[model samples]
Target: MGAAVTPHVVDSHHHVWDLSVRDQEWITGEALAPIRRDFSLTDLLPEARAAGVTATVLVQTVTVAEETPEFLALAADSDLVAGVVGWTDLTRPDAADALARLRQLPGGQHLVGIRHQVQGEPDPQWLLRPDVRRGLAAVGAAGLAYDLVVLPHQLPACVKAAQDHPELTFVLDHVGKPPVASGAIEPWATAVRMLAGLPNTVCKLSGLVTEAAPKTWTVDGLRPYADTVLEAFGPDRLMFGSDWPVCTLVAPYGEVLDVARQLTGSLSDGERAALFAGTATRVYGLRLSEGS
Candidate 1:
């Protein structure tokens, strides 16, 4: 809709949160307080529209047990949110029971996946522990996914999580939160390659600019990592995401998508379509049935 260069777009990652409801410990005093206010589907739709993104997957902002049902309710009434990645008590013994409960929510049909705040843990092996493995297995059995939200230093844990649970689909967030502004690439790229080697894995091209210094990030600043994801996962396993509201710290939604479009100019059209929209529809089961 924005231009003829691309068709429809399905953003695979973004978050909606209200400080009145809960606090995001990750956003502290000085850096990103501007986003502390509630960012719901209303605040997000305009930004996504400017970027030519039709629908998005609402990601869980907190690890609290109540938040998943909250997101499911929001997605159930909203059209812009095509799906959701909620959270569950991965280490709890009742994880399988918890997954069943999640399915009973009104918006559970939009619950394509689940996530835990693994980045908060100091131990990189947290995902591989026996109890956590059980939780991931429950997700795979329920036909849901687990998303990895970790720092680059924690990528080995992501690798372990993917390698150990070959049945669970793993979607890496923010290109492993790489240090793009500093131009640091080594172990990050190498780890990405290792994770991409897994057959059940996919990666989201989201939340990159926030990792770089705000406003100063150029398309080139994001290219190496973007190119790395595309090269490592190929088009079929990669999906685009705006990571909105949090991305407001870097640039507006339209400019961020411009960075993505420019950075991805080298890929063929079919590959671009997959990253922009096709992969999301397939992975999240967004293909609708016959007409109403």
Candidate 2:
């Protein structure tokens, strides 16, 4: 038999935070208590290495302006982190300037994209807000992608936003956070198909485990949602993300990766390669080491 092929793996989504540096206010309530302490790259590197993760994209946790620079610095210091999806106030008039300033900061080259906690916004159509749309344009002009962290109901606006700015790449985080816990896929599935129809849109296969009933979620429980995105976006536009530390709220890092592997097992080797790493490298413009 031929030797087993090991595809190059890149975790397209994950985060690191130091509580002492600044409070992660969202880490409240009993359900999030397990990850409430500090979670730094120091803690994640070993786990990522064990999972055969060659590189990772450190994403923002809060909207605070200081967080992005900090994450950039962390990326600069770490060999494992290849990119960062930081946050900025998209409502600001000089959002483009802010992006420029960020690019000038230390380790700025690692800033691959930007994201907002759109799921928390009360307005379902928040992405269509004029100011936010303008900022998204700036992101595109800066040659950076935008990560969508919206709920299922908000996907229509996401489609509109992507339609409005064909120049920008819209990366759907957590596959619009499907209602896996309830097992209802109608609206979410339909909306996902709409968004996927747009050429600029891509998706991440992360966070479904948490969206499902945390205590009862199984690989079978997650299959439908995974299949929906797989069929809609295909492997070339879908990337794997651990959403770690947060994923620890349900399954450990390795288990989360294992689930993703099982979900994508039916794909051809080249397709699996794109799902695990190549798509992220292309979408985020990541610069991996020579042999990695």
Candidate 3:
């Protein structure tokens, strides 16, 4: 008898942080208190293994340059983390040089992309800045993807940036963070569809549980937003992500994966496989061996 092939699930988006090393300033307010402490790769492995996730892409939580190298080092040491989407100052004139330097670091080979906290920037068009544009060019030239962690309002600029840099693949994290709590989909859906219209764009099926109405959110509540992206980007252009400790605010890790499965229940086996693994592998250029 032949051996059965294990399902290969890839968590395309998630984060890890040490609170003692640096505070996650964004983790303010009573609601976010649950996740104020440290979260590490060690903390994630068991749950990830239980969820049948063979590999994962650890993403940046802060804009600190030091954090990228740290994440790369972690990737180098870990078997499960195949890639890292770290942060680098896109406004720096030496952005390309910085990327080159990062690639030379111990685990730099695992760096698959760069991301900026566009949602936190006051300027909605921050991505369109000349300096940022130059950095984006450098990233494209480096042959790395750029992850867009933006709010709904910033998606227009996201579209422009994608249009301006057709060479780089722009990954839209968390479905542009739709207004799930309010059940509003107009502007977000319209903007997301526009971004999906670009050939160089991809979307992550993540963070919706946190974006919904606290603990009361249901699979049905997330369906509209999920359906919009599935129809817009299609399963091949979309990837699954747990969003991790942040998602813990609303549901546990297992529940998060279950909800994503339920939301994507209507897809064909191949389509679901693409959403859960293939898309992330192709987009991130993840180095996953059969043993992985």
Better of 1 and 2 by lDDT: 2
lDDT of 3: 0.93
Query: Which ten residues in a row are the worst by lDDT in model 1?
Result: 283-292
Give the better candidate number (1 or 3) by TM-score.
3
Q: Candidate 2: which stretches are off by over 4 Å?
A: 1-6
Q: Would you estimate the TM-scores of all the predictions?
A: 0.95, 0.97, 0.97
lDDT, candidate 3, 1-292, per-residue tens? 1212227789999899998888899999999999999999999999998888989999999988899999999999998999999988989899999999999999999999999999999999999999999999999999999999999999999999999999999999999999999989989999999999999999999999999999578788888999999999999999999999899999989788888888888887899889999999999999996866
lDDT (tens digit, per residue) of candidate 1 on 225-288: 9889989999899988888888888888887787778777877789889888888777776643
RMSD of 3: 3.1
In angstroms, the error of model 1 at 85 is: 0.2
Error of 2 at 43 (Å): 0.5
Give lDDT per model, in order.
0.84, 0.93, 0.93
lDDT of 2 at 182: 91
Clashes per model (N, Cα, C within 3 A): 0, 0, 0
- Residue 92 alpha-carbon offset, candidate 2, angstroms: 1.0
Q: What is the lDDT of residue 101 in candidate 3?
A: 97
| Every candidate's CA RMSD | 2.4, 2.0, 3.1
